[model samples]
Target chain A: MQRKKSRYIVSYSILLILICVFVLLSICIGSVTISWKEILNCVWGIEKERTYADIIFQIRLPRAVAACLLGGALALAGYLLQTFFHNPIAGPFVLGISSGAKLLVALTMVAFLERGVKLGSIGLIVAAFIGSMLCMGFVLLLSKVVTGMSMLIVSGVMISYICSAVTEFVVTFADDSNIVNLHHWSQGSFSGTTWSNVVCIGVVVGITFFYVFTLAKPLGAFQMGEVYAKNAGVNIKRFRVLLVLLSSLLSACVTAFAGPISFVGIAVPHLIKQLFQTAKPIVMIPACFLGGGVFCLFCDLLARTLFAPTELSVSTITAVFGAPIVIIIMIQGRKK
Target chain B: MEKKEYYFHAKGLKVGYKKKPLIENIEIPLKKGEILTLLGPNGAGKTTIIKSIIQQLEPLGGVMYLDGEDMFAMNRKTLAKRMSAVLTNPIDTEFMTVEDVVGTGRYPYTGKFGILEKEDKRVLKESMELVHIVDIAQKQFSEISDGQRQRVLLARALCQEPDLLILDEPTSYLDIRYKMEFLSVLQELSRQKQVTVILSLHELELAARVSDHIICVNQEGVKGFGTPEEIFSEGFISTLYGIKVGNYDEKSGDLELEAKKGKPEIFILAGNGTGSALFRKMQRKRIPFAVGVLWENDLDYPVAKALASEIITVPAFCRISEKKIEQAKQCMKRCGRVVTTLDLSILQDYGSTLRELYDFALQNQLVEEK
Candidate 1:
């Protein structure tokens, strides 16, 4: 057992190495493949005023960082929801929380565009947060009424559909010239990321991540479910509220920045657990952050490069990989 | 020796779901190093009272004191340090080994990060060993069988090093051997560690053997609470569970469903204790039987008293009375068949008056059930 657990050290190190390689790969290999020498020069401020420097600093760097942060946030959000619901496949997307945020963010965008007002990064995240919470509240209420895990997941799928339909309705009839932009954002790409947006995502998701880390102990207790968690001294009501808010904040951040990116939230944490061979939150929380970052960075690269000038949606790339894992998980769960 | 002071006490407790009380005016008390068993049928508010006392369900009205402190006034961590419970909640410890599962019992004592110290590890190891699950400690919880899983959970609760342990239907998934082993381990904990164990058990025989106190709960309330001796009197268990079809023999802790409620079809010459199983077999065969002349102190009395359609009796010391013999012969004539394990020749050689009754059965086509 000790020998097996030592593998966790190896897994963590491997995940860290993967994160580094993927971050660099995302930053260095964009449409115009800037040479390493030019990339080094731009980062080191040797050619600060050059176009190479502008592309590296203003565009790829912030976008890559946002993908890393928001992706980690999404996976951690999934982990929290999985723990909270005691369901392995429960995720922000699966529970329709991200779609909820998408619906509200789209509403906010349309409402602002009608008055010729632009929503800021903070404004978008706040709008998405409210939407995620609203959807989360509805799912929780459904959970109270439903007895089975399948029923809960089905209700969540229905919620995702309802939110997606409303977002489509808002997008189609909007008279703004930026309706094209609304359509693109709804497809969930990591493009249009700014340094300011990166900062907001960093502060919010970063703080929420740390808060989640603090909850690792109770979260571990929670794996045994509510009865044992209470016996283990967890203040369940307060802990439950914190769980909902933290998970909402994370998926809300992802939806605000990149639209409702799919599969990374549910799949990444599961992949990490398999890699580590243990679900101890002390290890899984950080592992999910790093794993989610690498996963999204890889998917985002595939999204941008696969169709070249006609970039595919990031979620389309993630769904291609993530949806299969979800299917496998369901099959395995049924077998169990 | 520990004095018999109450270690836990609950008074006037009202418990239910959604504040709609299912049971009311409950009171129970326990002493250190004693085992208490709760007995009730399904959905009799047994679990409700357990959950309520553990603070999982809010009591509509009550005050509970643990170790002389007002329980509701205590802090969660403090209460946790003193008490632990093994409930029926399903565990989803993904990839968690039994050791890792048991290590969770250290949560209340560990730092905010839930890192186990040497002491916590010591407690965890001792708990695993106590439950005889040390060999399986390295195995994943999901990989173990249901019985093993239950043992792991008990080990987890024991790892808390609590003064009081609560369990609900703890032995439900266990096989008979594991059931006895689990109860003995709890008994050892109670004796050696002075731990108080309060649990619900479905087996009345087992409950009678182990409990220092027994509580019977129903939808109405706590129907009865006392020593096992007090609780086992007369139709207490039957009335408490509202059993209509069966009879629960308090003395022997045997339950017998209403015997074929008609005239006797078979005459059973039950002697000594040889006919208890045959009595049950007759009952199962729907053959109402009249058993002859079993003394009150006889081993077969309890069972025969439960299932026999008619019993011919006489004072045990005196030889079977002529009047009782006549009565037995009359009842035997009514039976479609008379079966006896007794040999007429043996009874004649022993000069027992039962020979007369046996000879009377012989005239009526007596057949011995092997």
Candidate 2:
């Protein structure tokens, strides 16, 4: 027990240190880079009007915080879905939830742009939420008809493919000054996030996190299986609804802000589980949140800085690192 | 006939899936501390009944009263606080220790976050020790053997501190020793804690030995329900299992498949139940044989009844009669060999009869097996 406690402490400290390093990297290494000293001075009001303050406070700070919140949301969403389906590969992106959210957000953007109206942050998140729930409903229905977990994943991927196809179709035809930014946002980057977007994402993701954390107990019982979970006094009907609502909400919030980032949902929870060496939800929820936040901060930094003055898409960067972890899980699942 | 009030009873229960009944009219009255077991063939709805009782599958139509309260009407939280089950489907969990798995049984008592209090942890430890799984308390659940897993699952069930424990074929995949140990754990728990148990078992011998009350179910319906003595005496188990290939001995709780059927060519003088192994050997070799002058109450009577092609029997304690001796002679006329399971005490008790049998084998040129 003492050894186990020490392991958790060590894992938490490592994650905290990594998150701090990545947060600093995200703030210090963007275009027109600012050093930590200058960034600290900018925050302390030494040069309030300088380009460094403008860049750090107005631009990079919100984007970095958005990455932390949305990235953690994506990983929390992944862990719940994996627990629900009892499949290691189950995730918000692979299960088409983010694609569903992105499709509706894209449609909402195009509809408002054609009317010469811009979609506010709340409207996009609400639209994405409906789309996410719609896809989740169909996935639930398909899960019942499909006989195996593999088939369910295949169906999720097919759903993902269809949604992405529709989203890309919208991206092709909608060409305006607003659609140019829409096009950039549709490819999934943490750029251009404002302070208001950060507050909105933080509130929504924070409440969902509180609810998911409260559920760590029953979620632990639920990992045993449905029958045992019910036998353990979990109100199955209510618990299931909560799982669907919370996972969909978290993933939808991510898609609303940063478009559909892939593989982080499926990859980061698995990496944290392996690192912690236990699936106990109490430890895993916070660990996954930190691990995912650091991962996305690191990837978001690279996405903006790898070929500076020519930013890469965040999905492209995350796919490069996260897709291989998913493949490893699949191979190990088969070998076992 | 029904003088005492049963602590639990089901009246005209209809158990099935999706409103379709497979086995209906299941009437059972169980005392508070009794261990009742359901014995049946595959797909005979034992699991269905268990699932229904545990509220996994809603019963199609039934009024199950537990301690005089409608079972289905009780709030699930209250029911969950009182009842727990171990199903046949294996729990495929990852990274959960045996203690963690067992700790889940404290669900009804824990706060919303399920932080285990000191009492809950003590109960978890106590239940694991009851099942003698404290040694493997730190082992991963998935890494253990099936027997250990079953024990751990049972300990999880026990951690509920339930008044009633329900198990669906809990010993389906365990070895004999583990099977006995599993049932004995149930026995100990029910006896000490008054945790009424209703579990289905596949091992008929274990079922006969362990169950305080027996329930026989088949495709038709509930065939019988009573104490083990009342149920095992009526040849109902064989009928319940529909055994045409094998025989179930109600007397000894033993089972056997039918022997090779052909004309008898060897006769054996057997007594005091010494020819059972040889009888099985001949049956395996497909050789037809007959035995004579054995009492009906010998130790090998059930095996002999199931395997021997021909048997000539006398009363349980009487000497061999002239008519039976003549019948044995007639039956052994086609035999070319004689085997005796005789000893010196029997030779002294029936010296003249033994001498006559030996001389008969000699005169007929039948080779005597030493």
Candidate 3:
């Protein structure tokens, strides 16, 4: 017991140190270089004049914070969906929750541009939430008809494909500038994040995290399989629905604020499992939070630094890093 | 040791899907340290009753009590701590080790964080030892054989350290030997640990041999629930399966068919791990039969020992000796017909003996020439 506790503490501390380093790196390496001293001074409000420190503080800090929050939220959502559905491949994008949000955003943009109207971020967030909830509603309905996880995953993938087709049809008829913005948004980036959006994502992720944590015991019971979980005292229907709602909420929040960031939601939870050697959510949940934040921070750094002034999509970088890690882990598992 | 008493009591229990009861208004008392085998053919609602007792499927009409406490009111963790279960389907977990899989039984006691305490580890170790899978503790669960996997599942349930253990068709996929071994282990566990074990098994003979109490669920509701002798003798099983039970021999504890007259005296030329199931089938069908030329140490010796027949046998490993072959020919002469099990593993060099028997049968016109 003592050894286990010590190991946990050591892991938590190492993760904490890694998060700190990533945060510092996020603040340091951007389009404009700022010294560590200046970054600290700006954060502490010691500087009295408008300068590069102001730009870093105002623009990059909020973007980085938003990335961390969105990454953690998306990963947690993926973790919950995977456990609830008992499928390793179930995720926000695979299940069409993110695509649902994308469709809503795309429709809202086309409607606004067509009517010559300008909508605020809050309106977009609401549209995204409604879209995700509708998708969740459909998935939950299908879950009743479908008894198996693999079939449910296939159903979700089908829903995503349908949603993507609809979004493409909408984009072809929209204004060129609006289509460009929609295309860039669909690719997913942290460039549009501000303080208010960060706060909204943080609040939603915090609330959903607490709710999901309360479900840890039932989720662990679920890991044993559904019949055993039901015998073990879980009201399987209620717990499953609760998990779906929580996961959908988290996915919607991230997609609403940061657009549809792909691999982070699908791959971060699996990466955390590889790192921790266990899927017990108590460990994996927090590990996913830290690991996801670090991953997104690093990806964002690469997105900014790789081609200098030419910014790459953050999702592209994440997929490049995450796909190989998943394949390698899968190969190793197969070898064993 | 204190004599622990546990009684699973149901009052006016009704269970089914969609709130319309499949089996309703039923009550049964299951006692501790006893093996109660739920005996039924398919679609008899045995699974429903088991589910209701464990509170997996909600009781549509009534209440169940475990040790006088209301089962429905108990929290999931509390219920899990008291009752561990093994369902029919194998859980598909990709990466868990055998020990890790079994250790999950401690989830109820380990709190939400699921950190294993020293006591939890001790329980896990003891359970693995009890199930005799300690050697495979470090191996991945997917690497084991089906029988080994079943034992590992039993170990996992044992690790839960519950007062009552429930299993649904625990022997469905096992061969006969493993089936017997699995039931024997359950019997031992019930006796040694003072735990109440309730399982659904299709094998009536094995259930008769192992269970302390038999609950026979037929289409006509709960047919019977009592000791094996009381339940088996009540003709409930015969009615349940719609088969005759006259072959169920009481004295020898072996089933023997009442012989039919004017039929061929079919002497079974089988031995060495063959003829047991065929013997039972023939006996159940009331077909007259005999056996010969079996070695003393062959696997079929036990079945022959149980059957009321004349057997010619030589010393162990004395294959096809002269005296035994003569005895076989004499037995074939006395009988009007013959049947032989084609054991490819054995009797490959017995072609001459087979040809001799065939020629004799053809010469006497005892059987049509083939």
Candidate 4:
């Protein structure tokens, strides 16, 4: 117990340190590089170069914070989906929940932009929530019919393809004026987030994350499987519904802000679980959130800097690292 | 209201899936500290009945009273505090230790955060100790051996500190040693803590040993419900399972497959407790055999009856009469071989009739003296 407690502490500390490093690196290294000294000066209001403060505060800060928050939301959503389905591979992206959100948010964006009505972060999130719920409902129905883990994943992949196809179709038909903005947001990036988007993501993700944290106990019970969870006094029906709602809501918030970032949802929670060497939800939930933040912040930093002036989508970099981890998880699952 | 006669009582219960009754009018009345076991063949609705009681499947029709409170009326959390189950449902958990699994049994008692208080910790420790799994409390639940996992689950159930415990085939996959260990823990808990236990078991012998009351179930419904002594009456188990080829020895709880059918090829002069092992060996070899001049009350009677093609015997505790002696001599003369289970010195106490018969076999070169 003592060793496990220390391991959890060390793991969380490592994730926190990584998050801080990535956040700082994200702020420092950009198209116009800012050194640590300059960043410190800017923060202290010295502003040796005014552009440094402008880039740090106006551009990098909000985008980096958006990456961290939305990344945590994705991973938390994955954790909840995994718990809900008792399938480790179940996640927002793979299950096409994010694509479903993407499809609906795209339609909403085009429809509202056409009418000269701006879609706020809240509007997009609500639209994404409805979209993810519809996808979740379809997956739930498929889960009953398919039953096999691989088959469920196959069905989810199929759903992903269909939703992405419909989303692309909607984007192609949208008015020319909104196409550029819609196209960038649809590619799954943290590049264009504003402070208002950051604030909205924070409030929604914060409240939902706290709600999921409060469910850590029942979630722990649920890890034992449905029968045992029910035996342990959880109302399995209600708990299951809450898991679906919260998981979809988190993924919806992510899709609304950053489009559907790939693999982080399925990969980060698994990595955290391995690091902690236990799945006690109390620890896993918070560790997953922090680990997710670190993962996204790092991936977002790489996406922006790896090609520099030609910034890659966050999903592109996340998929490069996160996909292999998911493959490893699948191979390990098969070995078991 | 009628006075409560049983700590856990269910009357006229019906259980099935989708409100279609598979077994109805089931009655389970158990006292505190008593164990009632459900026994039946596979797919015989034992799990359905147990599931109904656990509220996993809503009882098709019934009223269950636990400590005189209507069980179905109670919420899951309220009932969970008083009743807990160890189900056959496979647990698919990852990275969870045995301690973590067992600690979940404190779900009803824990606070909002589910942190274990001192009392909860004490119960967890005591429960693990009860099942003798304190040593493996840190082991991964998934990586443990099946026996250890069963014990761990039992420990988890015990951690509920429940007044009434329900288990569905809790000993199904466990080996004999673990089965004995698991059931003995349950017995000790029932005896010492006065927890009423209800479970289903496929092992009739284990069920007979552990259950204070046994309910016999078949596809039709509850066939018999009584104490193990009553439920285990002569040939009842065979009839219940529709066994035609084998015999279930109610007296000794021994089960034997269909006996070899043929004329006797070997005859044995056997008595007391000596002949059973040899009898079983011959049965396994599918060889026909006979035994003679043994008192009916010999310790080997059950096995001999289960395996032997023919037996020439005197009444229990009676001397070997001349008529029986002649019959045994004639029986040995017809067989190709004779084997004496008793030593020559020990044979003297079995009576002179058996000595004369052995001498007759010796004269005829039929007895294989060893």
Candidate 5:
């Protein structure tokens, strides 16, 4: 028991160190490098305007915080999906939630470009939210009709395909400028994150995180099997629906603000599982948050630094890292 | 007969999938301090009935009462307090210890958080002791043997201190010894604690021997529900399985087989509690069988008595006597075929009765020695 507690403490400390590093990296390594002292002074309102410190404080600080929050939210969403479906491969992307947001963004851009209306980031975020909500609503409804996890996954995949087709159709008819916007949105990036968007994502994720924490025992019961969970006094139907809603809301918020950043959602939870050797949500939730923030911050760093001045899409960096981890897990799981 | 005060009462209960009823309009009463075994063929809705009673599946029609209170009116927590269940599916938890798994039985009383008090731990320890799994208390649940796992699951249910404990085919995956041991444990638990047990069992003999009440379910729908003797005598077993039970063997206390023509001479070499099954099958086929040099206190002795077969026995020890040898020779003289079981004692004495039987078969050409 002492050994187990020490191991838990070690893991928690490592996550804490990673979180600290990511926060420092987020604040310190932007376009115009500001000294740590200047950044601190600017944050504390001791620095004047019209300086690099002001840009660092006003723009990059909120953007970095948004990255951390969105990363945590997406990772938590993925953790819930993986447990709820009892499928290791399940994620926000697999469930068509990301595709739903992408489809909505494409539609909004196409319609606005046709009417000579220049759509803002807020307009796109709203459209993404509506799209994600619609997809979540459809999946929730299908979950009622389907009892098996595999069947629900198949239904989600089919929905994703349909959404992708619609997005493709919009892309084909959209003007050049609108097509560029849609392309950038589909390949998720954190370039447009602001203070308002960060606060919105933070609030939504905070509420859902608290709700999921309360549901930790039920989720642990689920690992035993659904029948056992029911026997243990869990109202399976009600708890499952609530879980899905919270997960979908978390996924929708992140996708809305960050344009559906990948890998962090799909890979962080799984990495946490390997490190912790458990599927309990109580452990997985905090692990997912820290792991996601670190992963996303690292990927963001790579996306910014790999091409120097030219920015690469965060999705590309995440895909390169996440796909291999997922493959390795699948292969190892199959061998077992 | 006086009606027993039942702890769990199912009244005209109709359970099924979708809209169609699987086991329809069946009324059964499970009294406290009773072991009720549900015997049925596949797709007979025995599991369906158990699931419904446990509220895992909702009954399509009719109501169930638990201790005179409406079953549906009780919340899951209250219902859990009244009843606990052991399912056939293996629990896939990796992190929980045997103690942790069994302690979850206090979930209903502990509320959703599963906080354990001194009384709860005492109950958990006692339940573990009852199942004889206290030695492996700190072991991970996944690392236990199958028999040990089954017992641990029982321990979990027992920790609930529930009035009714439902089990679905608890002995389906167990070996013969574990099967008997598990049933005996259930029987003892019910007798000592006044806990009502309702388990579906496929082992006919074990179920018949241990259960106080038997409910035979089939396509005919709740074919019979009464005392074991009452249900067995009603021909419910034959109807439920669509197989004939010719006669009851008073000695072995098992159903005997009717005689058939063209019987073979079978010399069973089983002893030291073995060959009961071979004896039963040989009786079923009406093959004339004899035992050689069986000890006085062996499982086959009772079987031989039940079948009314000729037997040779030594009072004690491994030494074969002249009188027993003569009895065996006399039986061999009248028999057409000679069969020997692969028993350890018979194998040890390769040059004795086995070789003697081989030589007799060779000379008489009655059968080729196997």
Candidate 6:
């Protein structure tokens, strides 16, 4: 027990340190390199040059915080999903929940933009939430029809394909004036985030994360499986509903803000589990949130600066790092 | 041990899926510290009945009382405090240690964060110790053997510190020794702690040996409910299972395969437990055989009765009469060969009368050398 506690302490400390380093790196290594000393001076309104302060306050800070919050939200959503289905591969992106949200958000954006109206952050989140619930409902129904985990994952991949195809169709044949704006968002990036968007993402993800944290006890019981969870006095029906709702809401929040980042949801929680050597929800839930932030911050940094003149979308970078972890989980699952 | 008031009473319980009752009117009267076993073949609604008692499924048409309180009326947490179950559902977990799994049984006792208190930790230690799983507490739950996993689950259930315990085929995947050890832990728990145990068992011999009360369950409902002696009555298990090809010994709770048929190919002079091995060998070889002039009270009587094609027997404590001896001669003469579990060198030691039959077989060259 003492060793386990020490491991938890060490893992959490490492994640915290990594998050700090990544956040600082994200801020420091942009198109124009700025040292931490200059960044601090800019924050304190002591910088003589206004361009550095303007860039720090206007663009980089909001983007960094958004990546941290949305990434944590995505990972927490994945953890809830894996627990719900009792499958390690279950996640927002893999289950096509993010695609579902992306599809609707695209449709909503096109409809609103065609009318020459602007859609707010709240409107997008509400649309995303509805879309996530719809996809979640389909997945739940599919789970009933096909009891095998691989079958469910296969059907989820199919759903993802169908949703993404429709989304591509909407983006491809849309009005020429809207294409430029729609194309970048469709590819999924942490760029173009504003202070207002950051506040919205923070509030939504914050409240949902607190709720997920309070569910740690029941979620721990649930890890043992449905029957044992019920025997442990957890109201399985209600608990399952709560899990679905919280997970859907969380993934919806991430999709609303960041436009469907891939694989961080599945990869971060798995990495956290390995680091802690335990899947107890009490530790996994908070640790997943922090580990996810660190992962996305690092990935977003790479997406921004890996090629200085041309930037890659966050999903492209995340998939490169995250897909192999998922494959490893599948292989280990087969061995078991 | 003799409490006048019943601890758990399930009166007219109807259990099944989705409001369709598969088995109805299951009345199990159990006292504190007593073990009630549900026995039946597969798909016999034994699991259904147990699930109802644990309130996993609502009773379709009846009320169950635990310690004189209506069970269904109690809320989930309250019910969980009083009762715990180890189900047959395969527990698929990832990255969880045995201690992590066992500590979850304190769900009802823990506070909001579900952190184990000092008392809860002590209970966890004691429960692991009771099941002899302390050595594997730090091992991954998935890495352990199935027997160890079962015991860990049992320890998890024990950590609930329940007054009433329920298990569904708890010994199904266990080996012989693990099954014995698991059942003995249960027996000790019941005897020492006065915990009321209700479990379903597929092994009739284990059930007979461990259960204080046995309820025979089938699709038709409770077939027979009584002490082990009453339920395992003569030929009752055969009737219960619809055994068409074997014999069930009520006294020893042993099952025997169907006997070979037709006329005798071999005859043997055997008695006092020596002939049973030869009788089983003949049964396995599918050869019909006969034995001669043995007393009914011999140690080999049960197996001989189960497998032999024909036997000439004398009543216990009776002197070998000439009629029986003549009957033995008739049996031995029909077979082309004869074998003896007894030594022919001690032919006079067995009885002077039996020397005539062996001498007859020897003169005809019918006896096979051992």
Model 3 clash pairs are none
Model 4's C-alpha root-mean-square deviation from the true structure amounts to: 1.5
* DockQ each: 0.80, 0.83, 0.31, 0.80, 0.35, 0.75
The residue-by-residue lDDT of candidate 5 on B1-370, one tens digit each, is 1233777788899999887888887887887778888888898888998999888888999988888888898888777776888998756675678887887677666644455789888999899988888899988888888888888888888887888889999987788888888888888879988888989988788877999988889987888888878876644566668765454443345565653323336666556566777777877667767766577666667666555356777665456766667776666666766655544345555226555655665577655344
Off by over 4 Å in 1: A41-49, A110-117, A172-176, B1-5, B261-265, B329-338, B342-351, B355-369
TM-score for candidate 6, residues paired by index: 0.95
TM-score of each: 0.93, 0.97, 0.76, 0.97, 0.82, 0.95
lDDT of 4 by residue, A265-288 (tens): 889999988899888889989889
Candidate 4 structure quality by residue, lDDT tens digits, B1-370: 3258889999899899996899989998888899999999899999998988988888888788998889877888888888999887888778888998899999999998899999999999999998889999988888998878888888898888899999999898898888888898889889988999999998999999999999999987889999999999999999888889978998799888788857888998887788888988888999999988678788778778888898887787677888888888888888869998866565654476778888899999997853
**TM-score, predicted candidate 4 vs. hidden true structure:** 0.97
**lDDT tens string, model 1, B1-370?**
1233689888788888996989888888888889999999899987888898789998999788888888888999999899999888777778888999999988889998999989998999999999999999988899999999999999989988899999999999999999999999999999999999999999998999889999998767788899999999988888888888968899988878788857888888877777888999988889888998766767788888889989976665556667877888888888857887655565543237676777777776765555
The residue pairs found clashing in candidate 5 are: none
Query: After TM-score superposition, what is the CA distance of residue A208 in candidate 3 from its true location, in Å?
Result: 2.8
Give the candidate order by descending TM-score. Answer: 4, 2, 6, 1, 5, 3
Best TM-score among the predictions, by candidate number: 4
What is the C-alpha lDDT profile of model 1 across A70-103, one tens digit per residue?
A: 8899999999999999888899999999999999
At residue B136, candidate 4 shows an lDDT of 92
Give the true-structure RMSD of model 3: 8.6
Q: What is the lDDT of residue A110 in candidate 6?
A: 93
lDDT of 5 by residue, A1-336 (tens): 577668767887898898778777767776667678877787787877567665675676776787777788888888888777776767887788888988887787788889999776567657776887798888878888997656777888899899989888889787876777667766788776667777777777788888888887778767767887677677788988887778777777777666767656778988887677655566777878878878887787778768867889888899999989878867865664
Select the stronger candidate by DockQ from 4 and 5.
Answer: 4
- For model 4, the superposed segments whose C-alpha errors exceed 4 Å read B347-350
Any idea how many clashes model 5 has?
Answer: 0
Q: Which is the winner by DockQ between candidate 1 and candidate 2?
A: 2
Alpha-carbon runs more than 4 Å astray in model 6: A172-175, B1-4, B343-366
Among these predicted structures, which one has the highest DockQ? 2
DockQ for model 4? 0.80
